[model samples]
Target: MGFDSFAMVDWSSGNDTGPRPRKDAIWACVVRQGKADEGPTYFRNRELAEQWLLDLITTEIEAERRLCLGFDFPFGYPKGFARALTGSDDPLGLWEWFEHRIEDSPKANNRFDLAGEINCRFGGKGPFWFNGLKRKINGLPKTKADYHSPFPERRSVELAPEAKGSFSCWQMGGAGAVGGQMMTGLPVLTRLRRTFAGKVAVWPFEVLDTPVAFVEIWPSLTLGAAPEGRIKDAWQVEQVALSLAGMPIQDLARHLNVSAAEEGWILGVSQRKPNIAPPPLRNDCFALPAGVNWTPVDEALGLLRERLTVVTAAESLPVMQVSGRILADDVFAKRSNPPQPNTAVDGYGFAGAAPEGAQVMPLCDGRAAAGIPFDGVVPGGHALRVLTGAALPAGVDTVILEEDVTVQDNHIAFHGPLKQGANTRRAGEDVAEGDLVLTAGRRLTPADLALLSATGVADVPVRKTLRVAVLSTGDELIEPGGTANPGQIYDANRPMLIALMDRMGFQPVDLGRVPDDRETLRDRLNSAAKQADVIVTSGGASAGDEDHVSALLREAGAMQEWRIALKPGRPLALGMWEGVPVFGLPGNPVAAMVCTLIFARPALGLMAGEGWQEPQGFDLPAAFEKRKKPGRREYLRARVRNGRAEVFASEGSGRISGLSWAEGLVEIEDGARHIKPGDLVRFIPYSSFGL
Candidate 1:
C-alpha cells in the first residue's frame, strides 16, 4: 500500500518548447526494488503532476522505505503543495512562510530538464555539480546567494509527507541541470546536504557533460529524505535504494555530505592520487628494464643482508682495546658518580656545631684538599669555609663562603645568614649507584671520552676498524712524483682509493703500487690477505694478459663472480684472497670508482658493524636531447642542472675527468637505451659508495 512511483524523461522539452517544459516525469512505488514507475504521470501539466504524485503516495502501505511519487516538473505553483496540506484559504501566505524558511536557495529563472538532473546527481557530486536554475523570489535576489546549485526541477509538494510545517522527507525530480564550467547538457547531481534539514537538491540536465557519470552521486546523499532527485528512472531508483538500503540512516546522511563536497558544492577538497609502491624488482641475473619496477631506495634496503662479518679479538681487534676507535658498548655508573660528598667552594674544614648566624674564626688549620678526608672537629659555634670540590669535614654540616662573613679580632662577623648545609655536594647527587652511564653504539666524541675517563672507564668494547690494504697493479702506473715515462700513467687510483678507505673508517695500509708481474702480484696479494681484512686491487680483473689479480686470488680461494652486465666495469671481479674479501676493479679511474660504489662500499660498512647502507637515487628529467636504442642498462656519468640531471660531456668510460665532474650515475633499465630530453631518470650519488 506504499506510493507507486513512475519516471518520465522528456528529452524534447526545452526553452523552444514552452514557458515551462515537462522535461521528464516519474511516478514510482518507492519499495525495496524502487518506485514501480510505469509511464508518464507528471509531464502533462503542473496540476495533473501534483494530483498524480498525491495519488501515488495516498495509495501507500506502511512499508520500511517511504511511499512517494516524484514528478519531472516544478512545484512552485500559484498554490504550492504546502498550502494544500495546511488546509488554509491563504495559499500565498503559506508560500510566503515557506519562502522565508528556504530564503537561502538560489533564484531559478530558467526552464529546467529532469532526466539530465538524475544523471548528474549520480555522477559523483564534484565541485561542478549542479542542482537546478535559481528561482527568483519577489523579483529580489537573496543577499547571500547559495553557491550550491539547486536540485532537479521535479515537484514533490504532494508526494512529501505534508502533514505539518515542513515535510521531514520529500521526493523530487532533477533533470536538465547545469554543471561544470560550461553548464552544458548534463544530468542533475541530486545532492542531499542533510537528510532532515528540509532542503532537497535537484540539478537540471544543462549543468553536466556526462550522463552515465551522474549515477556516482547516489552514495553521496546524506541529508535529504528521497532518492528521486538523483535517480528518477524506475530501475535506477530501485538500484540506488538497494545500494543504500542496508546502510544506517545517519551513515547515509554523512555519505551525502561527502558526495556534495566531491561534486564541488563544498570548499576545501583533495583530488590528487596517493603515492603507489613501486613494482617488484626482477630476480633474473640480468634484470630486464620492463620486467618489473625497482622499489624505493629505502624500502629496497630490506632485501639486502648486512655485509658485516663480526671477527673477535682472537681474530679481530675490539674497538675499546684500540685508541681512536668508536665505542661499541655503553658504559654506566656502578657507584655514585661523586662517590662521597665534598665541598663546593674553597675555604676551610672543621668539625663541630656552627649554629645559625653564628660566626667564630679558627686559626689557619692544615689544608684539607680534594681526595683528602678531614678528621678534626671544630670547637662549638665554629665555622669552616671550604673550597669547591673539596671533601667536607666530619661533624661540619655548613661551609660559609669567604664573602658571606668578615674576620675581625680572629673572630668572623655574624651579621650575614649562615646556610646550615650550604655549598655541599651530597653523595650520589650527580649519579646513583649502578645507573646507566653510557649506551652502546656511541661514536666516542671528545666529550664522550671525557665522560668515560671521569667514570673511570678507560678500556671499553668497540667495533674494530676494518683493515684495508690498497693495491694498484699495472706496469704503466707510476708513483705521483715519479716522472711519467712513455706509456706510464701517474697513480690516480691509489690516492683516490686511500681517501675512499679513510672516509669509510678503514685502517688503510698503503701497500703502494706494484707491477703486473705474476710472482710479485701473488706475493703482495698473500701479504695483504694475511694482514688486512679486505684487499682491493685495480686493473687486473679485466680480460687481458696483465690482468693477473683474479688468477692470483683464485690460487688463494674461490672467485665468486667475474663480471656483471654493467658498462664501464664489465670485468670487475669478486673473489677471496687467503679468506679475505678481495675486490678487483677496472684499471680506468671512472670504472674503478663506479665499481667501488656499487659493490665494495656496502661490504666495508658491514664489516665495520655500521647500520645497513643503501644507495639513494633520484629521478630527474634528462637534459640531453638525444635518443638511443633500448637494450642494456646504462649508468651515465651526469651532473644535475636547473633541477635536471644531464650526462657529462666527457662521458667516455675511460675519462678520469668524467668521474670528477659527475655528481652521480643515471641508471637506465628495461631496454631503455635511448633517452630523450625531459624524461625522468634515476641518479645515484657518487658518495653512496664511500667515494
Candidate 2:
C-alpha cells in the first residue's frame, strides 16, 4: 500500500535548559499529507514541533490517509537498560517516565536539571553525563573529564555489528552526542503517542502498516543523499525523505517483524539486503603492521612454510582406517597386478598361428579352465577349451573358443576365423614389481584405500591426527548453559571454533575457558602444551591491559607478529608455548572464524604433513559498490545471487550471525581503491576453506 505522506523531523537540542524559538531548532518536513501539499512545516522549539506533528497526524487520520514519520534520534537504549530504569520492561514506559518528569516551556526548560534528577534516581552519578553549562549540578558533571557514568556508554542498537560512527546517548552536550536530543525528543514522542492514541504506531516496538507509523532513521545509511558542496545538511532532509518514499511498500512490510524490541532498528537495513552500500572507505580499513613487507596469497603460502615446521612424528595404521590421514612415506605396490597373463575371453587355445582360409579345427584332449589348467600343450590344428583368466599351456600361442567354434562330443569345429593370443594371459602385464602407487604427503581418500587393498597392501605409515586444543579467554564470557551476570555474555567463539574443527576432521580437545588473571591464563596454556599439538585460543591476543596471552608467550616461549594484511582477520597473534604452536585469534566471532580458515587452516595442513595450500578464489561480479582504500586484502561474508557476490550489509566483526547467513567470502585484492557493482571480485566459497 502507498503511504499518503512521507514525513521526517531533523531534530535539535536548541537550548540546554530552556525552549525558545531558536534559530537552529527542528526542521519538520511532511510531504503531501492528505488533500495534497498540506505540510513540510518547520518548528522553532520542540513544543511547537510536537503540537504541529500531533495536529498533522490528527488531520491525516481523519482523512484516512496513512503517514510514515521518521525520527532522527534513537527509539530505545541498550537491552535491559530501559527495563532497569523503569519498573516495566516496555520502552513505552521509559518514554512515559521521561514525559512525566520533564518540564518544557517556550523560553525556558529544565532539560539539564531533569537529566540530573534522572541520574540521581539511578545511583546518584550516572546514566547521563556532559553538561553544556558551566554551572555544576548535583549528579550531572560540568565537563567531560569529570563525568563518570554508572550506565553503559553505548546502547545495544549503537553496538550493532556494522553501525559505525554512532553517538553515545549518555553524552548529552557534545556536537555528535544524541543524549540531549533523546531526552527532549522522547517527551515529544510520548506526547504524540498519547494525543494520537490508536492512530500512531512505532516501528520495532509496534507492527507496521498502521495509520500513522514512526521509525528511527539514520541519514548516513543513505549514501549519496547529500550533494558534494561547501554547505552541509543543505538537502539531506529532502533527499532522505524522497529515498524513504521511493522504497517499495513490500520492502517496508519487512519491518513488521524485527527481532529485538528493547533496542530498535534503523530504517533500510535488513538481513535480506546483504548487498547494501558499505560504509565510507577509509585508510584505517587496511589494518596491518606499518612499514613491513606483507605477502600476497601465493607468497603467503611460502612465508608460512618458512615460519612453521611440519610435524615429524608418524604412525602406521591400516589403509582402510586412514581415510583423512596424510601419508608419512611413499606407498609401494605389494604385488604386481594381473601376476601373469590370463585369458581375455572364453575360447579355444592352439599352439600354432592362424592358417589362411581355415574354418574347421579339431577339439583338443587338453582343457584349460581357470585354476584347472591343462599341463600339456595343445596339438597343432587342434583347439583347447579356455576360460577367462585361465593360464595358457606351453606352446599355446592363441586361444579361440565357444562363440566362434561349434563343438559336439569334445570335438570342436571352428565356425569363424581364429586369431593368435586373443584369449590367453600374459605374465605381469598391468603392474611391475615395487611400483610406487601413492607418494608421501598425500591424504588418503576412500578411493586410495580401495587401490591399496587391490595391491595387497594392508597398512600404511600415516601422520597421526593433529590434537587441537581450543580455549576461550576473557572473564566476561560464560558457557552457554551456565548463568551469567548483567554484563556477561555466553562465549560464542569457542563453540563455533570447536564445531568448525570437528567438521574439518581434527580431534578437538576442549580446554575450557581462562580467566583474566595472568597466572591462571599462563597455567592453562602450560597445561594445553602438554596434551595438544596446537593450542587455538580466542581473546587475550590484543595489547589490552586484560590480554595476557602475548605476554605469556613472549616470556616463556616464542612469538611471531605476522600482522597479516587482511580485513576482519588482521588482529591475529601467532606464538609458541613449550614448543607447541598456538594461534591467538581475535575475540570477535566473525574475525576469529575468518582468521581460522585463511591462516590457521593452512598452518594445520602443514602440520599434518600436507603442502601449504591457498584456499582457491573464484571471480564473480560484485553486487555492492564502495569507495575503498588500498593496502590490505578484505574478505566479506557474502552469498551468490544472480551470478553476483552479495556481501552482508554489516562489516562489524561482532556480528556473529553473518557467518551462518553467508555462503562464501568475497575477497578484495590488495591495492584496490574501490569496488563497483558488476566489477569482477574474487570469491572463495566456504566449502573451499572446508568450513
Candidate 3:
C-alpha cells in the first residue's frame, strides 16, 4: 500500500535526560502530506514521547491521510523466541506480554529488569545480556564473557548482505545495543495499536489497510554522517523520514512485501540496490519552462534545436552497409586517391620541354601501359608509347595524347602548344593521406561510399538506426484495413507517420491505434517506451476531455504543450514517457502531417544523430492572391506550375485531399501581407524534407 506521509522515531531507553537536545534522547520526525518537513522533536522521557506520537497520529487520521510510522527498534524477537514465550508464533502476542509486565516513568524504566526476568524464565543463563547499572541483577550479566544465548544471535534479515553493519538485537545496555530499546519501545507500540484498535496496523504482520501502519526502521541503514552542529539522533530521524517519503509509491510498496512476520524485517533492509529501469540519456532534455505560452514559429524551432540531442549509440559497420546511416565519428583518408602519379590518358610519354612548332622524337625501348610501368627510361628528346592509368616513369614530364600524335616507325610526332606536364596526373591530386574526408553527423550516401572506398576506408563508424513508435489515439478511429462504422473513421495517422519515419531512415515500430481510455493509452505508451527511442502519437494531444495522451504525460510531470503561432498546426505536445521522448500531434490528417514535417522531423533528425535538418526552399512567383493575418505564420499546400506557385483550392485544415494534391508548401512569414500574382514567395518541396 502507498503512504501519504512518513514519520520516523529514534527510540531511547534511558532516564529523563534534560531538555538540551543531547544524543541518546528520543527524536521523532514527521513529513506530512503536501507540507514542509516537521521537526525532529526532542523528548526527555518515554511518557512524553508516547503522548507526542499519539497526538500526531490523531492529527493525521483526522486529516484522512495514511501514515507510515517507523521506530528504530526490533518489532519482533528471533524466530523461535516468540513461539516459546507466547505459545503461538504470532509476534504481536509477545508485544502484549511485554505490555503487561513492563513498567515505565520519567525518572526511570524497567527494561534491564525485564530482560533479567525473561532470562530467569529460560534457565537463568541467557539470550539477553549486558547491564549499564551500578548493581547487577541475578540472571542478566554485565558483559558478553558471562552471557550464553538460547536463541539465534541475529534475525534472518541481519544476515543479508545489505544489512551487514547492523548490531545483534540481544546485546542490551552497551554502545550500539538495540535490546534495551526494543524491550521499552515494543510495549508503547502495543498500546498505540490497542488504543487506536482498527486505525493502526503493523506492517509485515498485518494487512496495511488502516490509516496508520507501523514498521521497524534502522536509521543507520540509510544515514550518512550527520552534518556539523546538528545532533546525530535528530539528523538520523529527519533524513530517514524524508527518504521514505520521497520514494515512488510503487517502490515503497515493494518494501512492504517482505515475509518476516515472526522475525520482523527493517524497512529498506535488502533493497539497497533497487531493480527499477534506468532512465534514458538526458531525460529532461525536452522540458520547457513553466508559464511559456503562444510561442512563435522561430522561437519554437530554436527551442527544439537547443533542447534536443543525439540519443543513439554508435558502432562500426562495413562501408558497403553504412549507406543511409549517420556518421558517428569523422573519417580520414588512409591513402590518397591516385596514390601515385599515372597517365591520365592513352598517350606517348617523353622527357623534354614542349616544342614551339611541330617536332618529332625517337621512340624509347619500353612502352608504358595501365598497371604495367615502363622498365626503361626515355632519353632527352625521346618519346615512349604509354596508355591510360600507367605510372609516370623516370625522365617523363609530359604525355602527348595518342589521338593528337602520329606514330610512324615507333616514333610519335606532336604539334606545338602542347604544354609541359599536360595530361599527366599528379600524386594525391584528388585527396591527400590523412585528410578529413567525412565529418560526424553526416548521413552516408552512395556517392560518399565511393569516396571512402577510393580513400582506403573499409569500415565506417555510424550510429544505430533510431526506432520511432507511431500511435493514433481516438475512440472514433479504426484501422484503415478494417470496416468502419458510422461514428468511426479509418485511422490515417499511424500509417502516414510510419511511412514518413521509414523514408527518413528510422525504424518505425507500428504501435497501432488506441482508444480514448486513459488507462489503455497509458499501457500502450509504456509498451512503446520499451521498444522505441521516440514516440509519436497523432491524436488526443490537446486539452480536451478525450485527450488522454497529453493528460498522461502531465500526470508523469513531463508534458509541455506549445501553442505555436503557425497555421495548419498550433498545439504541439512535447514530453517524455519512461525516458523516451514523445511528440503529440493534432488529430486532423492535414495538421498532423504539417506538424510532423515542420517540427518533429528536425527534432527527430537531431535525436537520430543526423544533426538538425532544415528543409531547403526556393523563391517563386505567386499564382494566386490572398490576404494573410499578422499573428501567425501560414503554409499553403502548393504546387509549382510554369514558374509560378499555386496553392490548393481550399485552405481548410480538415480537407485531407489537399495534402495529397499538392507537391509542396508555400510559406508566408508571420506578418500581414497583401499577396498577388507575380509576387515572389518561398516554396519548399516535399522532396526537400525527404518525403
Number of the predicted model whose TM-score against the real structure is largest: 3
- Model 2 clash pairs are 18-109, 19-106, 341-425, 341-426, 341-427, 342-425, 347-400, 347-401, 348-400, 348-401
lDDT (0 to 1) per candidate: 0.49, 0.73, 0.84
Model 3: lDDT equals: 0.84
**Residue pairs with backbone atoms closer than 3 Å in model 3 (clashes):** none
lDDT of 3 by residue, 443-488 (tens): 9999999999999999999999999999999999987878888999
- Which stretches of model 3 miss by more than 4 angstroms? 1-293
Per-residue CA lDDT of model 1 for 514-576, tens digit only, reads: 898988987887788778888888888855677788665433323324435555565676655
**Model 1 backbone overlap count:** 108
Runs in model 1 lying further than 4 Å from the true structure: 1-305, 312-321, 326-336, 347-367, 377-382, 396-405, 409-422, 429-449, 458-465, 499-505, 514-523, 540-575, 585-691
Please write out the lDDT profile of model 2 over residues 1-691, one tens digit for every residue: 3687778777777543233323245766665521114333456666777777878788889888788888888888866667777867688889888888777776666778877887788765777777777688777876566555666677665666445677777767867658788878898898888887887888878866579988887755443222223122324454455445533344356544465577777765544445577655556634333333544544444445655667647998877689978889998888776666667888777775675554666677767777887888677667777888788776677877567777887776664445566666566566555989899888788988887876778989988887899999988999898888998989999999999887766779999998888889878887887788899999887766887876565343233343566788756677666556789888889999998988888888888786675688889999999776666778889999899999999988888889999998988777865888998888899878766
**Candidate 2 lDDT for residue 392:** 78
Provide C-alpha RMSD values for all models, in order. 27.9, 25.8, 16.5
TM-score of 3: 0.60
Lowest-scoring 10 consecutive residues by lDDT in candidate 2? Answer: 223-232
